[model samples]
Target: MTIYRELVIHLKEETMKDIELLVIYQNAKTLLFHDSKQTNTIEDFVTGCIHHYIDRVKHQIDLSGINDLGKPYRLQNHLKEYIDKKGISQAMLAERTGIGASNLSLIMKNKNQPSLDYFFRIWIALECPPLDKILYRVEE
Candidate 1:
């Protein structure tokens, strides 16, 4: 059988058991076999897979609404959680806010802090509520 066919069968079986495991399988398989630009070393492959898995778990946490009240409002964490919950892609947000994709990525990663103007633009673009737990809250 072809590799793709084998992967399909394996994924089908995995999906019947756990969706998270299926996602991990698919990501690791793609990184190992499909990407031409992936690093050659086993260490790099393992590290990349771990990073990919962590990112997926983080997204799942956001999607699952783990937003605890009274936590400090962090722009990167809150923005990512909001966007994930609302099913908004970074590319879509960038287009809506008139920010470049790279800039938006940096903001999301907390590598760069957006200006107040950009924050307002993001708020408007995301259509966030004024008193949103993740996005904003009025301090007493």
Candidate 2:
């Protein structure tokens, strides 16, 4: 099977299980975390897991005497572009997505990076807008 296919299957299986763990951060640790109840948090965590899987696959491909697979996909700020293209004001987007207007302002101004949860909310608010011009679609 292709690496990408295998990775997708693995993630789907993992997502079905209840996960509990302790995460150690920079200097502190979150104690006995057993996932989140919020949809955004759960989606964000699942997105992170997908990213982790992709990275591991890429690293494996690299170590197997193959050509370099290049870097993981990273999102640049494209809120303004999307807003203009969709003909929506930042306030409207904020209201639709339930993200704070102030936070949306910060995102547009590049003052803050958005979490996956926030980004997904924006994407859904925009009626599942295409990211072809917004994010890198890394291919194997």
- The list of candidate 1 runs beyond 4 A from truth reads 1-77, 135-140
Provide the lowest-lDDT 10-residue window in model 2: 19-28
| Model 2: lDDT of residue 20 | 24
lDDT of 2 by residue, 1-140 (tens): 65533234344544454432212231133222544332334445556777988966665432221233464533356677778887999988988889998888888776676789998998888787445434332333
Tens digits of per-residue lDDT for model 1, 37-75? 442443344456768889666654332222555655444
Give all TM-scores, in the order shown. Answer: 0.40, 0.43
Pairs of residues clashing in candidate 2: none
Candidate 2 Cα deviation (angstroms), residue 11: 29
The TM-score leader among the candidates is 2
Candidate 1 matches the true fold with a TM-score of: 0.40
